[model samples]
Target: MTGGSTHEIRPLRFGVVAPITTDMPAWRDQLRGLADSGFSTVLMPDVPQWQPAPGPALAVAATITGLRVGTWVYASPVRPAWITAWEAHSLSVLTEGRFEMGIGTGRPGIADQLRELGLPLPPEGQRWSQVRDVVAALRELDGPDRHTPVAMAVRGPKAQALAAELADTVTFVMPQIETRAATVQRVESFDNRRGAELALHVPVVGDSVAAFMAGPDTDPAAVRAADSLAFLPSDPAAAAEEIQRRREEIGFSYFVFGADAAGALAPVVAELAGR
Candidate 1:
């Protein structure tokens, strides 16, 4: 049976990961446009020297009614777990239940970033431990009354196990060149462990690939040929159908796209969000 049979089907939800790059008024307008276009959440990535901190950026996005805001993901090893949890809990309170905390053990090449910042680069096991620590601290700060949904961006078996235990949403961080069959295997492995909402991160919509997601050498044709879930057809109808197929075959209900594809994916979101 497909992974969908292993868990309850969640309503389709769409989020946009767009780092702040404009003036306050312009950024506000962009956020409003996303909300107007039927997007549910506006997310920011946590990369030093690339964009403003996601917590403050998300706090601003949460000002727009009906639009939720979150960190596309906070790298757990970048800061102490308690500090990350404190900021996350504060943002949760500021957003008034409209914030979702997405955290991970940093991305590929994170070791270089750590070295650049004069921080010690811990081993993989330690990084995963930090992720768990962040969640535990966040829970303690939240206590029993407040519940801030945690979304974990996981890749390896250890991460998958941790996510199954702690996350409200699990986002699989697949490679740019990973084949469809490989992806199904990854999804099914997690499904066997636990039942949380599944999220698919789409970095390419049609021919346009977000630079943040794909490197300069990434070829769109190659990704499409591999049948990667990271790529989606730009056409609204086709994209919607493909999304539905994914939900049925692999159990992904939450689809997050890069900011560049926001306009292109709007119609699909309009047609399928909440269904």
Candidate 2:
């Protein structure tokens, strides 16, 4: 129901990338800024160094604004599925149903940290198995009492198949242009004739449009057309257009916006909202 018919509608939900910083004030300000900018959701990464405990931030965001808050990718191996399940349910209840859980194989760096914590990194195949099992457990928690959907952030072939089988949504963090196209292609391949919804996590660089354009593979023509943003065009709009172009070419619709920093998201949000 949310995405409409698979072919006719473009899934374009805009959200802020989270963990604005370790500074609590900065984090809160980022949330406030995103809410002010008309963003309805935020994606908090589960990087140990940056992710604050979900308690205070989730509570405050619920109290202050109607922003939907959830982790971008909670490391599946770092915590047991039950504990993650409990925390997710608690937040869902606390936020009055604005919580969504994103789970993935913990990052390689995170695996090293797990070693420091005296935990063994499960072998790669086992890790995916664990993610699948964990997702299954979360899905079982989806009765009327706990209705939040679990989204999976997947990269490789195995994980992609698991995502198609288990997740309500599949997400990808696209750091480069080719990766973006590849992500759409992979999703299309998985969904087959039935188009799938994809949530793309994109980084926002600056206050101006030019900052977004400052990245590699920028198109000059896109810079001319993206004047909606006041700051010099960094070419985020161009980047977004490229992504959309790829999606159309590959026959997939649905995207979620994520900014590297909280402030970096303003131009992107403006552009998406047709400002």
Candidate 3:
């Protein structure tokens, strides 16, 4: 279930994770930088403060930047299915059809925030059910009239199956386990029966990056470096080798780099370009 075409040497398609900040100018600048750096896609997740609203910033991002823009995992419980569908459609149209929407159950922190905002919270099981329904609603849109393909970020069996059944792609953040073999098996086990293509979301870290500074409590720097290196090759040829190796091992062909800024993005982009 690969997203788009996987016939190229690098079966993995590269994209950057958008910085979720309220500063619209900074966000647009980051998008421009990513476009200039040769990123083909960008993942804009639903952050509490940096909620995705179809506005001028997104409009400019679509108009000025050539990179494909989409959400990593937009929270489904935050809005009605129709509203989410409408916003996604608008962005897709605004971007001239370079948008994709990834829906998922709200994370714990996001759930808490939504609760504070007085939004109703569904049970965990029902949340996944809603995820499927949301994707179905988006799929109902007419061709060319729809802005983006809908995908889901999932971890468990139930969620993975939902993604497989409804979404065009399935994205996974690197799990706590250390080995690529484990990662591959985990994704395969969850995704084997399902048909959605897999996309692995790997973070790219550098000095002064937010994730680097504020990740889990155990040697933050080392964890940050390790996470960044997961998608990177030890050498130039190694990238292609790793891509093929992971694809054969795990069945995933899409790679998304969740980076901090321009500086952190350059090295990864350069390495992928060499591949």
Candidate 4:
């Protein structure tokens, strides 16, 4: 299956995040353009960053015919589980199963953003507690039939364990210290425990990729390590080659790109869409 489709072997799939601007019409066009460019879906990040909120942006995606929308991850620590459940449920319905919800313990700097919003920034335990709670809430509402596919953005042992137990997908958030052998080991660890799909979320920094899109504070050395490329070549042919190599190496078949990388990434999406 490609991009979490029912197919067994992970298919090569590419996706882009929502653009960093809030022009509604332009956002619509950007998503449409990505769909036209062969991207399987468009995912949005949940942060106080330049991107729009996943709900509204996903609503925009609903208007477009072919594109799918997802939250790269909703910051669970700052936001309550029930609220996220409701939003994700509503979005899944509105989009007719064309939505995917990515959940994660809030990223760095999210505490600062939460502080500004007066949202409670709990300790790691409380934050981690909510991840399963939210998933349970969604499942209680719809069961497997209506529950939206959730991709957990996880790095640590606790978070990864939670993902294997509860999430429909586990997107391993490669750390700055990430390496090929380490990635392989992590993947192996998730292999038996997770009942759902496996995905890798990483930054792409290289020629043709804009800095804004390469992932937050991306390390060039990390990108080049052990041929585990969450960040890869920007050239269409070269990018395609890189993807094929990595898929063979560690089976990273699904990819998510940042907004700034869209222009540089569309070609890669087009080149190796189904192969």
Candidate 5:
């Protein structure tokens, strides 16, 4: 009960949550910035806060070669399964086969957020059904020449079953598990099989930047300082070693970071991106 899109992901790959920007000039710059800065891919969240829609933004970013683009995890409850299908097909064309459709049962707070948008958040059981519907639709719409990988971000046992059966990449987000053993257990629970990729959407911040930003007059806004977000060690080499050890135990090949922490995390990217 596994899906078929394996050629798209690689071990030790890194991607960043795209920075928000309304103008094309800045958007293009940011897309190129990721490529130049050594991120393997660029991810756009399918949240209301984004300026351009995730599919369209990925399409635009695809104009730059060698940069893979994806929706970090589209909240399936927010739209009909067919609409989700449309996005997958559209992004496949838009990115010329360089897109990954990441889907999830929208998170907790999003229910309140969706209420503001005049959309009700469906229960977990219903959202799980829609997730299956979306997967089936994507498979039906896919042809040999036009295809997009589906990345399922799910945590529960039922949802994990759906992900294992229908996703190309299985993603997990567990920022609260602060220990290596805890992180390893979380990833092991995915039980990723052959022909699938494992992507862990987690925090990554280097030590040097944290130390520098701790100075008395450090501008919080300038550095996007947040102690909770800095999860890795300070030294680039030390971070690389820790990440390598984690990857060995957890089998997570793809790592994603927050948009604001890109500058702080770049040193690790530099240290381990191409290796």
Candidate 6:
């Protein structure tokens, strides 16, 4: 059963995962466009080799627009937990509490990246400890006067438990093959365990799919056919209805979309964000 009946559904919030594009002026314009378009947050991915470091990039974005700035997620295994915490705390203080720290164990193939970087490729449990350590350090740094929101991406029982205990927001990640029924069950299970805000990461909005969301061989039609949370209809009215359906049926209130969908969904954002 849908979990909307069990808990208070949160107000709708929209975020865009926009990587830093060329020149500063362009980046500023892009961020301002997102803010003007009703997006609440602008997030950066933590892939060091592909983009400028997320910390500095996010700080710059915070200065350019009134929109909140954050990491779509920081990979905990790539660096020391204290260092990541320090960066997160600095961003929060600089942004005046407009920073949301999303942290998780590194994603699939992260081990190969670690090997290339000559870093330790720890066991799954050890990676989670690093995530916990980052949040703990962030708490110590934030102290009583300030609070920096933590969004943890979890896919397993132990990770979900840690996120339930420590995160202000939690996003569940699952295999691409997982159906809507399986996704709802996972969210319901998490709701049974904790009451934090729930976020859904949308990789395909309409016909556009972010490059990082899928491989060259991955078909957008296939993802859409699976009724995946990653897919959303392109039509503004239809997209709005579907988003509301998700909130009603799955209790997902925070919807994060790829940069590609920002323009396509602006009308939907205007209609439903914060409503």
User: Model 3 off-target regions past 4 Å?
Assistant: 1-10, 20-26, 50-57, 143-147, 192-195, 204-244, 265-275
- Candidate 1 — which residues are off by over 4 angstroms? 1-5, 191-194
My TM-score estimates for the predictions, one after another, are 0.96, 0.74, 0.77, 0.86, 0.81, 0.95
Pick out the ten consecutive residues of candidate 3 with the lowest summed lDDT: 1-10
Residue-wise C-alpha lDDT for candidate 3, range 1-275, written one tens digit per residue: 23222322334466766654647677777787777776777766665555545333456566768877777667878888777776777777767788878778865466677878789888778888777666666666635445368778787778867776667777764533345655655564563343556676554333333342123443435644444324443243555566556666566567676546434546445555434
Give the residue spans of candidate 4 off by over 4 A. Answer: 1-8, 20-22, 191-195, 208-228
* Model 6 residue 150 CA deviation in Å: 0.3
TM-score, model 5 to reference: 0.81
Model 5: runs farther than 4 Å from truth? Answer: 1-10, 175-178, 204-230
Candidate 2: pairs in clash: 209-232, 209-233, 209-234, 210-232, 210-233, 210-234, 211-234, 212-234, 213-234, 213-235
- Report the C-alpha lDDT of model 1 over 1-275, residue by residue, as the tens digit: 43434656779999988787767887788888888888898888888888788887888788765688888799988999999999999998998888999998887789999999999988889999998999999999999999899999999889988888899999999888799999988888674345788999888888998745556677888889999988899999999999999998888999999888988889999899999
Evaluation by lDDT, superior candidate among 2 and 4: 4
Q: How accurate locally is residue 163 in candidate 6, as Cα lDDT from 0 to 100?
A: 85
Cα lDDT, model 4, residue 5: 31
True lDDT of residue 117, candidate 2: 76
Residue 254 deviation, candidate 1, in Å? 0.3
Report clashes for each candidate as comma-separated counts: 0, 10, 2, 2, 1, 0
* Regions more than 4 Å wrong, model 6: 1-5, 191-194
Ranking by TM-score: 1, 6, 4, 5, 3, 2
Question: What Cα-based lDDT does every candidate model obtain?
Answer: 0.86, 0.59, 0.61, 0.72, 0.69, 0.86
lDDT of 6 at 96: 95
Q: Could you give the candidate ranking by lDDT, starting with the highest? A: 1, 6, 4, 5, 3, 2
Model 3 clash number = 2
lDDT measured at residue 114 in model 4 versus the true structure, 0 to 100: 86
